[model samples]
Target: MRTDSPRLSRPATFVRAFAIACALFFLFPRHAHSQIHPTVSFEVASIRPVAGGESGGEGGTRSQIETTADGLTMRNIDLSEMIEWAYKLQHYQLSGPNSLAGSRYDLRAKSGDHVAESTLRLMLQDLLATRFKLQLHREQKKTSVYELVIAKGGPRLPKDKSATIPPSYPKETFPRVVDGGFVFQNVSLGDFAQQLTEIRTIDLPVIDRTGIPGVYDITLKSAASALLDPSGPSILTLIQEQLGLKLVSAQDLIEVVVVDRFEPPSAN
Candidate 1:
């Protein structure tokens, strides 16, 4: 007599089903799975409006932003500045309501201790989109820019010795502004070009074309106020003389962010 195979127990049936599902998941393509996952975001976040004229930490301005491996903090910072940080865009590349610079807010966000800075920026972008209802688009436009190139004497940048210092040594501050000058430590040519854009004298976007590799410790002693004084040497002359670098003006198509819509941030 033929007898039907003994019915499997409930636990055995469940085990078989789970094994099949696991096999299917492993067999699926990786890209398909990635499409199902959501973008990384902060674990916790707080955003509040700071009163007008209020100051942040010592020497901090309305646009100050600090980031660590664990999180990031912004005090008395406006949306325009935050957008710049989030998208790694220069001030001239951002086009939005002038009011974006007027509404200041303090933001604190928490993330995994090992999260990278780039990932934090992405999270901040997500925060702005969800919390502030920010909407924007990028378009190319012709703009004036400066290319940073080596002067006739070649580069005179000092090597950053701090790179060899032990980790225990106190870190030296860089890209520092003093009296009428500026100092940059452990900076690459690209970074130096970006920092130059922050100076009032350098009104156009600075692009690095030096083709020089490695970091440097550079100092520019020219007075920023001198930019307004016709008698004083211009920044172009100062850079060429001091750092053996020159800024050449050129017109190019640059990608710019244009704000389509933005609403005041929702309640925390």
Candidate 2:
């Protein structure tokens, strides 16, 4: 005699299907479907408050920022200045608490290996977020800015023959200050405009509108004091006469970083 097998119930069939699905899931590699990407950060970092809180003279409290392929070092720098450097922004591009500049700190950060300046900036950003508990956002606003353009006589800039097509980053030598003025070697117009923004005399955002390409060697003979001396020629006049460049005052919509929150760095 033949016998019939027992039929499975609905609940038993559902449990059997669920068991098979779990078994298939575990059979696959755990990370096959998903990948985790971690934020870029420095391998080692140290931040310490400076004593006396004195200015570095001429350049304000920020003494200097030194960066290499492997790391970065900022001496006698304030949070505001660090923010400016880390974000590649001008002073006008940042809106934050005046207290950000009140305190000074020396920061040294190292990476596991050699990296680009762009990567170093990201590491600095990460450090700020983690150490200072910093929070910020960007917004557009109409502001005063100076546009660097070719003057009536045209640009007197001499193209640097030795300069490469794409200039290297973190140039070894920046514009140097002489007794009377400044000198730029193998610098682009955009870079020149950026340097102008740091002048206490200019004291305004500078935009490169010359539309000129290639690097140049430039020298401005007018003293920084000329910008303030009523009897002396203004920077506008000097620039036109010496560099064949003009700074036109204009209003523009610019993106500015607004600091929402920042706290003293946590213990090292």
Candidate 3:
């Protein structure tokens, strides 16, 4: 008589579910699985408050965080801005304590190795969790926002005539501060939307509604005064006039990052 082999005990419900997901991921087409999220953490990190609480030249996304082979430095950046970089969300998309909104910090994080900008964001998230006790959730909320769309005439910016389809983005990326504002070359529509969102021109994060796809060259500039004047040409106007893209007003379900709690960092 053959003895029956002992049956393997089933794992907990959550574990079973996870195992099933993994099985499906491997058994099915690769595209069926979600893209792997890059995670990079700092080997040694320090977070300090900006003494003056004032954002100077080093402020804004353009100069927010710089990652080198050895480490990364974030200067004069508020928690709000930091979250924006970590999650790639707009400041308007985040909500938390009033103080946290304006509280800026100088962060020095090192990993001893160079990583992609996308990976750097992951490291920033880890740093926030370890230091700031940051926590957040995502929800879709109905909000009135501008959708970037091609105007009746089409885009004012010219397509890169010499741009030939390449396997990837250009190796020689142009400097962002070409003419004082922001310039992009060999950029895709998705990348352009992301750049526009970081500019803080529109009150709400812009949603790209343009049906256009592919890479192109873009130059955008707006006088601070122009954006401040309600009657003057705003970023929306600039996009329409210069880029031939319009930000149409519409209500859509937008992803909003909800901050549950954020405690101040511990001692350095």
Report RMSD (Å) for each prediction in the order shown.
6.8, 6.7, 8.9
Q: Which one wins by TM-score: 1 or 2? A: 1
Best by lDDT: 2
Rank by TM-score, highest first: 1, 2, 3
Give the candidate order by descending lDDT: 2, 1, 3
Clashes of each: 0, 0, 1
TM-score of 2: 0.73
Q: Please provide, for model 1 over 1-268, each residue's C-alpha lDDT reduced to its tens digit, 9 standing for 90 to 100.
A: 9999899999999999999999988899668856786597899898888776474443344345677657888777789888988998867789998988778887889996657778888999999999989999999999899999999968788876646743222112225766677776556687688778877767899988889876667778864656668798887888898889999989988899998888999988
lDDT of 3 by residue, 158-229 (tens): 765445754322311122754445566556665576656666555665677787766677777753445456
Better-scoring candidate (lDDT), 2 or 3:
2
Q: Report RMSD for candidate 2.
A: 6.7
Clashing pairs in 2: none
Query: Which parts of model 2 have CA positions greater than 4 angstroms off?
Result: 1-38, 53-62, 158-177, 183-188, 200-203, 213-218
